[model samples]
Target chain A: MSIPITESITVIDTTLRDGLQIEDRVVPTALKVEIARALVDAGFRHLEIGSFVNPKKVPQMADTAELYRELGSLEDEGVTLYSLVFNAKGAQRAVDAGALQVKLVISASEGHSRSNSDSSIAQAGDRLLAAIQVLKANNVAFEVGTAVSFICPIDGPTPPQNLVSILEPLVAEGAAGVGVADTIGNANPRMVRTGTKAVQQAFPDMPITVHLHDTYNFGIANVVTTLEMGITRFDATLGGLGGCPFAPGAAGNIGSDDLIHLLHREGYSTGIDTEKLAGIRPTLTRAIGHPLSSKLSTIPAVPEPAPIGRASR
Target chain B: MSIPITESITVIDTTLRDGLQIEDRVVPTALKVEIARALVDAGFRHLEIGSFVNPKKVPQMADTAELYRELGSLEDEGVTLYSLVFNAKGAQRAVDAGALQVKLVISASEGHSRSNSDSSIAQAGDRLLAAIQVLKANNVAFEVGTAVSFICPIDGPTPPQNLVSILEPLVAEGAAGVGVADTIGNANPRMVRTGTKAVQQAFPDMPITVHLHDTYNFGIANVVTTLEMGITRFDATLGGLGGCPFAPGAAGNIGSDDLIHLLHREGYSTGIDTEKLAGIRPTLTRAIGHPLSSKLSTIPAVPEPAPIGRASR
Candidate 1:
């Protein structure tokens, strides 16, 4: 008998943007484009290619425009390219660069908002509205991401009502979608499911994407819960790269290969090639001069056939 | 207004027993005693102190009797010490060594049972019955552990009916309590909840302990889900130590310090000194010859205040 209620998941890789943010060395615009192409080739349909933030703040994203130009030229069919933006100015810059979508991040925790964005929820919502207006004017799809939606490292627990309150204005302002980020990776599966269900109930039609970090090692579990909650789109990094330079205890994003393997194993359709994604770990390892954090990077000694039986089998 | 139902969780440190099973080197009996003492000192009420198995099969557990003798002399008033065994002889050995309780592990997965114990589920159950009879005759408390209860790495997903069948006989054979072990770390939180509820329903009064491995990085999430199901007791290793020496993908138990921190943060009373437990990582690191897999080992820049805020504030 077949198991009922299988899920279809979409993996959105953000290695070039968020992944490179944690790297000490600058990744050239060409290298970013190359990684983007590699992710696309690996069957990642949604790619948060880069960010349109100030070059001074994020020197690695200094070549965001150049990277976007290169990606636009590739005209990679079957891929939706996206860029992260902090404010209206960044949103405008992303639109000017012909970016298809832009993501604006706000913090759900007040302490995180003050420390990371220097704005309260109300002020952050204003900036988000302004950014959404700019994206709307340019006819670009936009997503508002609420960071520390699960738990904040600076502040203690994020009350669910606080998160729902913060999301209400963004949904009312006509945000194309919402991204819930466990910024400091403190979310457990129960918390993820609770928050996701609450958000889904509040905004029935709004598309929700979960951005998770592996700091506390709940990234994969949270992703699983999100999948069960009918959230298909997720944010992952190649080789589990990226952490916020500003956020203490911020570690790698959930590894693309690891996430894809999990999704595939759970009988979900994620379209990504696990072997190809595992192949790129060497390049990232060489570039970073250290091993990556993905468990799938090193092949286990006794390779059991994929669970659910391989499609070929 | 009260948000939800939360309960106190009991943490059972199993590092010296199950954790040592996966160690590259055989941990000295003295080291096991020291680790057990540390766990007890850190306010762990129950500890799986050692395993009474054949030296040829599991060299690391060969010192089980010696370690048990050492812990027996220790002045731990609150700690309920236990040892693991496979058959009646092992239970006799533990009872002779002054163990308060003994655990017999029965593998639910046929492939694991054959590989791990050279027996089938029925044979293992028969062995467990003999062991329980021996323990009961000696008036020593005992619990039955069902390994690979959720899923097995060797065999694919274990059907719940199969698990129920394996457990039913044990419950009838005078098992004081029962535990479910995610032997190869393949269980997600949903699986944990489902499996736990089923077993709970089958044996309502049987105290259930959940042993999780962080192989797929869902260990903590699984623990969280089990806790939500009102299952209190859990097994954790110091620094995420121990894996199945024979199981291919099984690596690292859920770290004790990490789990304690997570529970403490979620308002669950685990009674563990997080700071003292964090301090124990160094000694474990020295013994293991490298840093362990725990994320909480690296001291957070924002120092965690003493567990003084809850009751006092």
Candidate 2:
């Protein structure tokens, strides 16, 4: 029997934000804008440019507001730019910067919540309520996402109830969508399937996106598993850049180039031109100042001049 | 809503044979025996030690006979050791070395067959027919395997019909089992699912094993897809050791260490102790004179003191 494949999936390029958020060298605003424009030109409509965290804490993303202002022209092109916001203050910063969409992120595990947000999951949720209200007041569209939704570095595996409870307020307040992330790049496919399914069952109508890191080389496998569960959205970074400062052992996010290759090979229409995507990788490589870890970054693209062996048949 | 996982799977460690075949340095015979011994102690019942090919062409595998002699005692312990044979002479060499079992491999694609064996598929099959007769005369159990069963390096994809056509003679000869190899590690899950399903349908009673390379980081994903197709057997190399000399762009076999980690995380029993398996990696690394490419080889094992997250729930 064949896997029931979804015809198409939406890819949100998080290169400028998650891909560069943890890099040692802070990229200039102009370079970031250029990268975003390149991504948009390569057929990505949804892009996460930066997070609205404290500039003092995350210096790399200190220019989020500036980036929003710089990309104001992209908004007219039907581009939906997203920024991460944790509390009312961040939401206000996003609103003040003319942000149209924001993703409210909280850790589902107490351990991650303490380290990443300096609060427990409940405390974080309380803080996010204020952010939701601020986002509502500003009339900015918002979604809720959980960090370490499957496994936690300190607290260990997060129960599905933990995720559901963490998401209660956001889901109840009519968040536009939901996202679950493998914050540490450690969750297996089965965990993703179970956790995502739990969310799918609870909010059947909500658009769900999974953000994964290729820390264990299980990113694509997890993506395949989620696809089996009917998920049609994923978040990736260009040239596989990204890691969380708080998440130990986390590697780069799944490479947009590699993921698109898998999606296309599996007969899923991602509507992104891989050749054009590959063209932008050198800029990312220079921005990160290191060799990118995604498979496509290392290997030259094989020309499909003709189907080899049985593909011809 | 959860993924329907298989209860168990069989892992065949092919490090000694496939992993070391293409290395520039030829490891010592004693080291080969020690590695095989460590693998068996770690609960790997199946191990492919060496191939009975031209020793001059494959100098790294020149110690095949002596290594087999050294490991003869392992047969009494319920360990099944496999060596590859192509022609009647190679089959005779295996029998003379007291090989209880052998695997006859040929490329499913004409492109690979011409390059790897310096013969056409028809010519290779004619030679394999002689080898099969020799194996029967020697009372040695053997199985048939096809390299590049899905995608070929020179040729593109091998149609399912090509694989079936290649396996027809061996199946008619009553081969013990069948193995389909992604010789170049370029196959995506769709190709794997389609090609493997074709083989499975043709030989419903045949036990099939998949040999994959992690060239594109699709090894584990292909494993997951095949598992979903009810494929229970896989071949892997330790520390992700092994690549193809004939197949360009081939990286390493899906690291046995990494594959086992995925299988265990997905709740499948492989009967192999990962800790013990990991212990043997340093030795292989020393022998190979380089670091292994597997994810587990680079990272510390995640302590599963308790199943975290939704798995616990």
Measured by lDDT, the strongest candidate is: 2
DockQ of each candidate, alpha-carbon based: 0.28, 0.52
Give per-residue CA lDDT, model 2, range A1-313, as digits (tens): 1344559889999998899888899999998998999989999989999999889989999999999999977989988999999999999999999998899999988778888878778888988999999999889999999999998878777788778877877889879999999988898888888899888888888999999998888999999999888899999998788888897788889998889988887778887988889999888778778888888898877654144423443
lDDT of 2 at A309: 22
Total backbone collisions, model 1: 0
RMSD (Å) per prediction: 3.5, 2.3
The whole-model C-alpha lDDT of candidate 2 against the native structure comes to 0.88
The TM-scores of chain A alone, one per candidate, are 0.93, 0.95
> What would the per-residue lDDT of candidate 1 be over residues A266-290, giving only the tens digit for each residue?
5678877777776677677766667
TM-scores, one per candidate: 0.90, 0.96
Q: How would you encode candidate 1's per-residue C-alpha lDDT over B34-151 as one tens digit per residue?
A: 7777877778878887788888878888877787677776535767877887788888888888777788888877788898888888888888888888888888887887888877
What are the Cα lDDT values of the candidates? 0.76, 0.88
